[model samples]
Target chain A: MGGLTVMQALAAKLPGERFLYLGDTARLPYGTKSADTVRRYALQAAHALTDHGVKLVVIACNTASVGLPYLQEALAPMPVIGVIEPGAAAALAVAPNGPIGVIATEGTVKGGAYVRAIHAHSTAPVVQQACPLFVPMAEEGLTDGPIAEAVAHRYLDPLMARLPKPKVLVLGCTHYPALKGVITRVVGPEVTLVDSAAITANAVERLLDEKGLRATEKPGEHHFYCTDAPDRFARVGEIFFGNPIDPGAVEQVDLQ
Target chain B: MGGLTVMQALAAKLPGERFLYLGDTARLPYGTKSADTVRRYALQAAHALTDHGVKLVVIACNTASVGLPYLQEALAPMPVIGVIEPGAAAALAVAPNGPIGVIATEGTVKGGAYVRAIHAHSTAPVVQQACPLFVPMAEEGLTDGPIAEAVAHRYLDPLMARLPKPKVLVLGCTHYPALKGVITRVVGPEVTLVDSAAITANAVERLLDEKGLRATEKPGEHHFYCTDAPDRFARVGEIFFGNPIDPGAVEQVDLQ
Candidate 1:
């Protein structure tokens, strides 16, 4: 539901930093497609972001993180960070022991990036589920109703029923954090919800500080761009960011 | 559910003709997107199809029909058919007068192609409703269940309650034919459901025959191509086509 998860994280954590956010609404929800297509779309989106001459970029989307290397290569010397690593690290820290359950978009789950990343940190049996409908449900703003609960139960029931019960449920898709209440209720009180947005925000802060690329501007202004459907971005942007984005500030650009 | 609606219609109608079908499984369901994005994608898809040396191109999708002129211009002298004209023609034929109901994707409905086409034929009030979830529902194979009925009732109830009730309800999206049973029940026996697939197939037949492009050969071969994720196409493709498609036979092509 909240497509601007990482952007919100960085914007909130780094008040002095200016951002040129680009949403590839044209080929969005890249969570369900093949690896090759996601990689291609990610590169195109990264190119659009860098075209604005921003000093730093964040692949706020977990699915698009697969093409981080390509983006870094293309925009060398300019810093770029992806959400997956930060998310995995956060999940491991949250649950030092026991099984970890990860719910993400179809592509991220199918890509097994989270599973592999989690394995590197801990020996817990990481269960990954692709809740494709969660994105649509989140976009519709049905965060805690019967429909959202039913959908949550549909995806979380099996993960909770594993032999080694998962103590930490990583909300891999950014939109998922909106359904946190419903997800938490379904998974019960014993499970901790790890949001990638907060984790990535912390990572962005650390990376910027360590690299000596910190900015000192106060109340930084942000501009938004989209590959297609700027109107949709302006309309739905409020759901992601609590504040309404000015329609005039959100412009459409050709990513091709 | 009937992803191959138009193609299935053509396959059934013209058994002796060779067909090469390309499903843009990567960036699909163009019904909710902006006109510019849809036009660009349609052009890319059409160009991919023509690369295979096909004699004619058919835009079975109502949403992509807007890009027909662009496709025609790009591949001049090659025959092309869009589902909109055929669907509108079929509806007018079934209901020579009065209000005509059209249900399709958001892009197709908002594009107002049906309204213009219907007005060109009859002075009847054209009622167009955008059923954005129908495509997802159809793809999920929830065609005739309670969920499908509920969705159908939700969309068709308003159209059915019109002053001059719609006599013929055009199933604008290709995938909509699968939901016909539910739509028919909701609209009652008084209303006729016009399927774009059948109409477009007949139009294709007429166009081919008039141009003397009919083949006398027996057992025509069919080829399938996808821009990305052939596995998804082959899986959901079974609902569209009554038979299962061999994944090996389905080739992946780069549209870019």
Candidate 2:
């Protein structure tokens, strides 16, 4: 999913902040990368966002958030928030007693970011499944149909096979939020799906409010920039943002 | 998949030709954008490939290949080959008499690349469905499980429900080749599956040999680059090209 969608969702949830999103569409899905590499990319992205004069930079990409320390260090003065911590906190808040499940890309799952965050707060046995395909499925807009269901099952069966299934599941990647319906069905009515994006959005709102840096009046200008083609980002940005977003304003930027 | 994977695969099929692949993993999966946008991205990618000093540039992404004329115009002087034409040719060769089904990202299906290519050579009716999620699934390495199957069915049901069961199905995207098993099951035993990568590999071999541009002796360096984090591409590259693959060679590139 693109950053615009996350920003849009965050804007709707908080309603007081001016957001400028730069989706690294040219170089997307940091999910498969190493922590060091993700950190570097996140740092670059953070610099871009801060340069746009955003009050606070939100590391919307879960991969980047999982490796947030580097990003935090990279953006020394600007406040940055990631989805992992907030989502972990939210999951721990409501699910103190249940088995917590986390599904994300192989890299995110391998990073043990959610597991670490969850373990810090609760004693629930965290079950993790690398639902790598969920991102592409969501990006392709395969939310609820038969194909989506099949893909969901393909990734879910192994996790479900383990005894004492997880009662609380973390949709670790931002892209996975789009697959909530199919994921919910596959896990059955027993599981509580926690979307990290929603939690992250809430965290952004809270951070902005606490810092007293909310953008109040004007409908802020959103200049979409991607390392890749702006045109491609615009088309897919609509799907990612959960709306029909136009790419007319997007300007392609080189992130060297 | 990396050009390294393509080179390795084609090395056996084509024999003794030097292969250079520019995956554009930094700006991957050109399947969700508009025709013009895809063409532009393809041109940029082609220029990168051309700059590598290769005799030909393969628009490996099916989505970009569908916008061939525009790409052709954009990357003039350099002989360009797209996956769509070769894949279509292979599908027709196998099922000249029966209906052919194509599953790809929205852009590919919408562009009618496969349909147009196949129709040019054979009388067989072509059935197309936009399986946009398949790429993410494959990239994430979730091809074997219930999730993969579910996603496949989600895309297939609508297409299968309407069209006659195809004797051949084209795996238009490089990522889709990894999903051959899941797709085969969904499409059934009767349908033949054609992978665009395989066709492109063979085509590249043929073209290089015909032009005396095949590498002479030593294996060429397969330097991978991405606009995003190279580590993610490297990890996924392991799934595609096998483990023990070196990501140290994945350089960070700016594609603006």
Candidate 3:
């Protein structure tokens, strides 16, 4: 579900671009693993995608983006893009000066990637809040309503209590966008919610144009690959995409 | 933390027994995966455990135990023990008849292993509740608090509302023991909570004794292996084990 926003970006910004998505279903929630481990898995997956000969590699997952350097190095000469930088940019644009908030999974928050990214942007007070439950709730398709609201309130209250509370909150984890309504309600009217996927997609489009690698004018075709359980992947993909997915092009791959 | 209960049992009940525990830190939270994929991963892990020359394979994870038949079949001649049957037996002992509840990960409950096991004991009405968020909370060591209580109340409410509600509730997942206090408070009086790990360990003891495979009177040394991220595993193990652990003993093995 963390890739939903990225997928949406694929549709909106680069409608004619072909995408090859590989979901490491066997080793999901990479947000819970150590830095080195995340890098290794991300490299493995990037290699799998490269086997298909992709032109650009997008780390659609915020968790996997924790290992952006490894992914980039593993796929050298090919362009590598990650969600963190785009989200950090959006936060900087919105807050500009001080007091911005970041919400992500425990690993992503603990990895300090977004915090580091934002700090590199400006000295804006960045509060990293890990809403561990949001990922499961989003996967359950419990995106909106009282349950999401309650959970959001609990996680955001501490971040909100600071003097001159955050005016811009980055949906640091892609999954956070799924719970946007509830999260927006919890954070109240003052904060601008930055959508990382949209910003990252814009970046991708810019990269393609700059590299002069834009595809010929034709509708794009995309394929999906999962390390394990294509059926479960489809079920989850349907929830994230908010529609019934076509399973025809989906394949279950064993990443060595 | 899936094997925390089993490890606890190993230390207290079979102090003389040698154990080799494997936590598949890579493909974790097997609760959300398809049955076939779980079987594949569990088999790979079992093969790794067998390489240590251990006499037994205990599927310490309740969620992984859903694939026990696969593990037992793959590793025949060497015995394989799972937690579901033991937990069901404990539930039967507490309630004796109808109206029992079972709380586990979505995979374990949805697998219907507990229902099948409990049905063999008695034709009890088993309510299988998947408090998926509880595992993450427990891993974070947020066992008892307003957040835990609120989550517990939300998840336990429907089970509590059942007419002449379940008199006995089985803590189906090993991780459930960490949330025992909050769960107990939510389920309230008149309901008995059955711990699956304790019961499973007792079953393991009986099996070894019957097979004449019981170790001689000497405290035996043990080892721990993880498919990935041994450092993260050690950190989480400390939280579950409630003490600092020796990271030197934790080996990260790639079970290909």
Which 10-residue span in candidate 3 chain A carries the lowest summed lDDT? Answer: A214-223
What TM-score does candidate 3 reach?
A: 0.94
Worst 10 residues of 2 chain B by lDDT: B2-11
Per-prediction DockQ comes to 0.46, 0.34, 0.59
For model 1, the superposed segments whose C-alpha errors exceed 4 Å read: A69-77, A142-144, A163-165, A218-220, B1-3, B144-146, B184-190, B218-220
Which rank order by lDDT, best down to worst? 3, 1, 2
* CAPRI docking class of candidate 1: acceptable
Name the regions of candidate 2 deviating beyond 4 angstroms: A2-9, A95-99, A118-125, A145-167, A181-192, A215-256, B2-9, B33-60, B64-79, B90-100, B115-126, B139-168, B181-193, B197-209, B212-256
RMSD of each: 2.6, 4.6, 2.1
Ranked candidates (DockQ, high to low): 3, 1, 2
Which residue pairs in candidate 1 collide? A1-A138, A31-A107, B31-B107
TM-score against truth, every candidate: 0.92, 0.77, 0.94
Q: lDDT, candidate 2, residue B138?
A: 64
Using DockQ as the yardstick, the better of models 2 and 3 is: 3
Every candidate's TM-score, chain A alone:
0.95, 0.93, 0.96
Native-referenced Cα lDDT, model 3:
0.83
